[model samples]
Target chain A: MKVLVTVKEVAEADDDFAIEGTDIAESDLEYDLNEWDDYAVEAAVQLAEAGIADEVVTVTVGRERTEETIRMALAKGADRAVRVWDEALDGAFADVASKVDLFEAVVAEEEPDLVLGGVQAADTGFGATGVALAERIGFEHAAVVNDLDVDADAGVAHVHRELEGGVEELTEVDLPAVLTVQTGLNEPRYASLRGIRQAQRKEIAAKDLSDLGLTADDVESSLTITSMYEPESESDAEMIEGDAGESADRLAEVLREKGVSA
Target chain B: MSVLVAAEHRRGALRDVSYEAITAGRELADARGADLHVAVIGGDVDGFAEDLNRDGVDAIHTVADGEEFDHNAYQAALSQLADGIDAGAVVLPNSVNGLDYAPALAEALGVPIVTDAVGMAYDDGLTVTREMYGSKVETTVDVAGDRFVLTVRGGEWPPAEGVGDAAIESVDVDVPESGARVTGFEEVGGGDVDIADADVLVSVGRGIEEEENIELIEDLADALGATLSASRPIVDNGWLPKNRQVGQSGKVVTPDVYIAVGISGAVQHVAGMKGSDTIVAINTDPNAPIFDIADYGIVGDLFDVVPELIDEFA
Candidate 1:
């Protein structure tokens, strides 16, 4: 079985940042492997380690700057990676459909038996790409899966979908499936020195829209980001102003006034 | 054109987000001069339909199906209804189940989708307001077409009240054979303590940095005679057990005092504890969303402040 995982390099705002246009200033944004995708990478790598999956491939829809982040996935045991980018993709926020268009093309070529991805990208938080991809590519899908057990013989993936309020629904999804993994499914491993050295020599197949037989028109996004701004703070909290000890003193007083005691 | 809002339910009861979606749907329907149609699929559909018949709802459609949410069934039923009603805007709850099917439903209908919407505006076209970068910034997205799908966040709007006499209809649709089957459900986060029972909750989050440092928080909780709880990451890291987790998927807590330590209030975490009577936030970043809902705040390092807090209580 060949397993494919969708990875993204998500952006995090600094302690204080500036907004430029419809996004945070690039200089103010720090990029890293999305925390959720790290778990997905680990899940796919484990399948390969267990010999159930012959290849563990990671696919990312990001710009050239995102290669550094994808390399981390390779170091953590993804066999290889495919980075999808194009000059056309730089415009308008790539909606869920646009991402599905790109991944659908890769799914056509790779034809992996299983696809794993994070429940949602931390930056976009749309949480829809994985399911949409499954729909477009005609694959089975389970979302917010917290536990997974794959049976290649039965062609079934037994998963526990994490629901709100501490409930998990156990489901069996047929093979050729997409599972959007949640955090804590497994502890993601750090890249070792040997793996880092090997990652530099490993292949990262870079493909553009044309390579995937897609054009700017095929991936044209109907969504436009009109404005960006910091949400106005509704806080009316009484800020305890002081150094640590001084603030603690006031906090103790406040806690006492609230009748808190041992 | 009509605005369709799909109501959500789990086990036996309709979720609050379903009512919230109704309120949001009404807003959109009013804006477009369109009728608001509410849909409830599976699990006591008739009961769900009655509860969903709130003011401004012009019609209600219920599909009698399985007991719980099956994305395939939801996708089929909603698509058929949307097509039948000629819906221009479909509003859905951006819950866990919502995420499971909304994208596919949009794809099936060949429409654009935006999830977790906090605000919306309809003028010449539809624009949605959503948070990004862990709620550090908000962005307004413009959809170029007249028809679209939206999954709305819970608690963003008031629940629809003052029941209406909506015309109820039973929609017959074919639920196709699915590749996924939900066999059973298991309740997690059940162990020693229930944080929901606590009056004062000392919750820790990512800022604690390491597992060993959780001791400091335990010490503080011990000193205050309070129960110790945590945000989702702490539980996700196995530093704290699920029972001690205070978040959407863990437990909803409304303690008298929710002392958030080293936690930047992510939306999910906030959903569980924002109802606390006296919310206190202690973090280095004053701009953290935790402070926005905090009743009292101390902008300082948890390392410096938490130990001192322990000493004061001791």
Candidate 2:
């Protein structure tokens, strides 16, 4: 089976960053392989290592700058990568449908038997794209999957969906499915020096909308950001001020006042 | 046009988010000058319908189906329900199951979807307020059309109370067989410690950095005479056990005093511990959401402050 993992390079804002128009200042935002997608990549790569998957290809909808993050997935063990970006997706909030469109196009071309992605992105945090893509492409899907066991012979993926609370629902999804992975699914391995060197030579196929036979209008987002600002601090926390020792003394005093101590 | 809310139930009990969704649904219904219709699908729908007949509810529609949540059933049933009611806006809980179907339902309806909405306003069109950068920055999203699906964050709206005279009706719907089959449910976090029983908790998070450094937190927990607990990442990393995890998917701790060390206070972690009597945060990032709910805070590195804190108690 061929597995395709959807990877994203999410931007996280630094503490005390300035808001520029509708987003955090570029200088203040740091990009990294989304924490969740890292696990998804590991899951896909593990499928290959287990001989359940013949190839593990990663697909992403990001700019050229994201190749570094995409290559990080390759170094960790994705065979190749496909990155799609266009000017239409530059500043707009790509709604769920818009993203599904991109992924659907890639899926049609790749024809992978299995698709995987993170449950949610750290930045947008929409938590919708994978399922939405499943709906669009007509495939079975399980979201928030913390445990995945693929039985290639039976063409079933036994997954544990981590519902709210401490309960997990065991579900068996047929092959040709999408599973949005949750964190803690697996420990993502760090890229070894040998793997990193090999990744430097791996192919990262960067494409525009036209390359996928898509037009700019096909990816227009219906949702727009009207305003962006820091949420006003609603905290009334009495912050302990001073050096570590002084703060520790104050915290201990507070703990003692709360009737807590050794 | 009406606002439709799909009530969620699991294991014969309605989740709190169902009532919360009713409140959110009424808000949008009122703003849109439409009736609020609540739909409860599957597993004792008749009983669920009665419980969902809260204030501002105009009607309750029940679709008898399977015992547990099946996204295929929800997407098919709710899509037909929303269509029948001509719901201009659909309000649902932003819970895990809700996310499973909301996006698909929105796609099926060919409308936009806004997930994890903390705030909403319907003047002419709709505007949603949601968090970004893990709740550091708040942004207002404008939906171009009046027809959209919104998944409201749990705890954002108070659950609707006071039973209203709502007309109950059973709606027959065609739910397609799915390629996914749920086999069973297993309860996790069964271990030695129940963090919920603790009076005082000294919780550690990712800021503890390495697995070996967790001993530092255990030392502090010992000196303070408090139980040692952790955030999700710590448990996820195997640095701590699931029994010691305090989060939405872990034990909900309402300790007398909760000390959050190196935890950035993600919403899931906050959901489990926000009810604690008192919260104290220690982290280098002053803007962490943990500090927002904390009664006391120390804006410094855990590495620097923890040893000193252990010394103070020693």
lDDT of 1 at B108: 94
Cα-based TM-score, every candidate: 0.99, 0.99
Residue-level lDDT of model 1, residues A1-262, one tens digit each, is 9999999999999999999878899899899999999999999999999999999999999889898999999999998999999999986699899999999999999999999999999987889999999999999999999999999999999999999999999999999999999999999999999999899988899999999999999888988888999999999999999999999999999998887887
In model 1, chain B matches the true chain B with a TM-score of 0.99
The CA-based lDDT of model 2 is what?
0.93
Please give the CA lDDT of all the candidate structures.
0.94, 0.93
Native-interface RMSD of candidate 2: 0.8
Q: For residue A141, what is the lDDT in candidate 1? A: 96
lDDT (tens digit, per residue) of candidate 1 on B205-262: 9999999999999999999999999998999999999899888998999999999999
* Ten-residue region with minimum lDDT total, candidate 2 chain A: A85-94
User: For each model, chain A TM-score?
Assistant: 0.99, 0.98
Error of 2 at A34 (Å): 0.5
Candidate 1 accuracy as TM-score: 0.99
State the displacement of the C-alpha of residue B239, model 2, in Å, after optimal TM-score superposition.
0.9
Scored against the true structure, residue B237 in model 2 reaches a CA lDDT of 90
